[model samples]
Target: MDLHEVCDLIVDCEHKTAPTQAEGYPSIRTPNIGRGYFLLDGVNRVSEETYRSWTRRAEPKPGDLIMAREAPVGNVAMVPAGLRPCLGQRTLLIRPMRSKVFPRYLAYLLIGDQIQNIIHAMTNGVTVPHLNMKDVRSLPLPPLPPLPTQRKIAAILSAYDDLIENNLRRIKILEEMAQNLYREWFVKFRFPGWEKARFVDSPLGKIPEEWEVTTINKVTSYINRGVTPKYDASASSLVVNQKCIRDRKLNLSLARQHKSRVMDDKYVVFGDILINSTGVGTLGRVAQVYEDLNDVTVDTHVSIVRPSNGDGIDFLGLALIDLEPHFESLGAGATGQTELRRDRIGETEIVLPPVKMRKQFSEKVTSLRKLVLNLAARNETLRRTRDLLLPKLISGEVDVSELDIAIPEEAA
Candidate 1:
């Protein structure tokens, strides 16, 4: 089947509008408000004010094609429902006649390498690359399948998304539980024998009788800083940096390679937690090195901790990640850019429980983290399969109609 270029399907498109209801009015300044993204995937929401400011004249519905046009282009995302009227100045809205193409299918087609390459080509500018709308519509769109088939493919992909979303929600619950426990036991002084508890004057002020206030350095036998010699494309080493840690987990999807670095057995493995002792935004961010951690090389921004005989890695990691906001405030200097120094991080104190309590806490949090890791691994696999199948289905490289999406018998 011949691919149908977007140019042929055009019913209408609009760009220029009356400045203050026609008749020249003073130009109103439009702020980006960090509310712009072109090649976005899996973004859930945006601010109502930003949405209103974007779509003052008209509101866009869900399933509309949104393309970034200004300040460097090649960004796209489906306009989700329940959004206040939002418009994009540097973005293009490609609405297909439903009689011709399914909007969701078209949105699916624009993901992965095909759209990535297209965006790269459309980018034009020195400082900031802007996308040309003329070239955007000129780009070819594949001949689409019938409505039922389009919906089927979408359903198959959506199933994977549903599972992934559920797993994300589960992870959130696990983190919250851990934090709530910490707050009750530590901050609110709600141990089993709180009324009978006695305070001790340790290095960390007034900790409970059962608690030992100690610096994190004592909990770990080896505290070392990692390095990346240089960035290299061909190298196979997984180089982790400050940005790799997000929401208390290590995101290895964005993991890159270093030229060459020291490779060792103690490098990174299951349940190893790394802390960002100092950086602009990532100071105090904690990353647990699990799943796909092999031959991993880290950089200076990270501080690696190997738990001593008394502590468990998972317990400490969860604790650190849970208290990241507090750690950031304590470590950060009131300046233009926030930073947490390595020495200052050591100076900052935390109340430590006994070995038995540490292990018990680790058992709960690690089980949760383990569940997250397993789910994450599955999500990664699903993502890769979906990405691989996406282009094939869109470009007609594979017959999507012939594909079988096997739902369980009960589900069916």
Candidate 2:
């Protein structure tokens, strides 16, 4: 069946960018549209007036799906019950016809391998892959099961999504706690025993008595990016690129296999901090390697920063993360493309707290960071399991009809 046949209404977004504010209704841009779910972290906000103006065609409701039509081209995410969001540029709001097809089921179907492949095929021969209104309406869907079966399949998948969402929330909270502590102690100069600590003037600013304002080069064992990889389909080693580092976390699944030889220092270690060293928007983003990554090397676009000593690796990692904005500003080049030079990063100023004080901070934040990493690993596992079931359930190859499942009220 055609997508238009299943959807009651498919509204295109306001062509112009909506004016954003500090806080208001979230504007669901293409970047926020993750597969089968929304990624709302750092989403743009618009005033109530702009939200009304932008959503004049049809306001996105709880069950509607927001799909990207360009840049990425076909990723889709369903709007949850609580979020009141307006469409952003190059996006579409799809409202499924409840009588014809279940909303969540259709969302799952759209992100499924078959539908995604079909969507990609339509974008072929285009300068920038995008869907015109006609093509979007004409996009085909695989044969759907009966409404009851559809609900059951959606419920089965929703269970996994529910778990993943829960973990994601927990991860967010854990990360905030970790970063907050770092800010309080280091940034605000409120670390324990601050009252008795004598103040001193430094190049960066005022600091505790014995603290040193140092450069990244002075304290790191190694500071350089990996060599460009010779990509081969059957390669065993993985290459971590800018895409692999996001939201201050390292996602190994995004890493691609590389056939190139990796030097000893080029390979990322457990405590190494990876920074996106090139490109306008991506440069200066940082993520710490949590687990042991075997035979994994980063690309030229990513620089590896390994600490000189074990005592302050945790402190150094969090400190570097806090300097992301500073690093971003330091990028040199034209507006479109910017590069964070190795020397610039090395010469970047960092305030080093006393050794004992840093060790104490590290002990506290390390526990929180570990919790965050554990939850992230759990989410990865859940995602893999859910992906394995998606195709089978959507295709009706694995019969879910006989298996009793409770359909959520939202889907009903």
Candidate 3:
């Protein structure tokens, strides 16, 4: 069946960008559209008036699927309850016909590999792939089973998603806990025995007398940008690029394989901090390695900042992570030519606590970061399991009719 037949409404977004403001309804752009859920963090907001004007054609509601039509072309995410999001550029709103197809089921099916490949194949553009509205409307879908079966399948997928979402929330909380700890101890000078500690004027500001202000180069054993990689699909070594570092987290899934062998020092390790070292928008983004990586290195656009010692491994990463905004300000050159130079990064100032305090901070922060890594690994496993099951369930190759599955209300 054609996508249009299963959907009651398929509306295109405003051709131009919406005017964004400090607050109002969120504008759901292509970047905010994840595989099956909206990635709302840092999403643009518009004034209520602009929201009304932009959504005049069709306002996105809960259960509606928003699919990217360009600049990625096929990524889709469903609007959840409580979000009043308006469509942004190169996005289309999909309203599935509830009686014919389950909304969540259709969303999962569209993001399935089969439909995603079909979407990419139908795209048109020399540099950036895009989908024409006509092609999108006429996109073929696999034969759907009965509505009950569709709900059952969606419920099974949703279970995985629900767990993943829960872990995501916990990860966010854990990250905040670590950040708050850093701010309290380092920034706010509220560390243990801080009240009775002597203060002195320093380059960064007044600090505990025992603490010292030091440059990144003085503390790190190595600080350098990676080499330009020769990409190869068959290669065993994965190279991290600017895209792999975001929101203080390293997503290795975005890393690509490199054809050539890298030097021993070039390989990323468990405590190393990876910073996006090139491009205007992405420059200065930082992420620390939480798990042991094998055959993984970084590209020229990323810099590896390895701590000098293991005693305060988390301290240096957390400090660098906190300096993300400052690093962004340090980008050199104009617009697209901007780069985070190795020298500038090395010269960046950071406050160093006493060895005892450093180790204490490491002990606390490492525990929280370890939890984040574990949760992330669990999410990876859930995603893999769900992805493996997605196509079969969508294509009806794996029967759900015989199984007694309790479908949730959201799936209904």
Predictions in order: lDDT:
0.60, 0.89, 0.90
The C-alpha RMSD in Å for every predicted model, in order, reads 7.3, 1.7, 1.3
Model 3 scores a C-alpha lDDT of 0.90
lDDT over C-alpha atoms for residue 295 of model 2: 94
Q: Give the TM-score of candidate 2.
A: 0.95
Task: For candidate 1, write residues 113-200 as lDDT tens digits.
Answer: 6765766765634467765555666675545677667766666665765576677677668667776776676667675567887888
Q: Tell me how candidate 2 scores on lDDT.
A: 0.89
lDDT measured at residue 276 in model 3 versus the true structure, 0 to 100: 92
Q: How do these models rank on TM-score, best leading? A: 3, 2, 1
RMSD of 3: 1.3
Worst 10 residues of 1 by lDDT: 25-34
TM-score of each: 0.75, 0.95, 0.97
Ranking by lDDT: 3, 2, 1
Which parts of model 3 are misplaced by more than 4 Å? none
Error of 3 at 185 (Å): 0.4
**Residues 177-296, model 3: lDDT tens digits:** 999999899989899888799999999899899999999999999988887899999988899988888888998899998886689999989899999988887998999988888989
TM-score of 3: 0.97
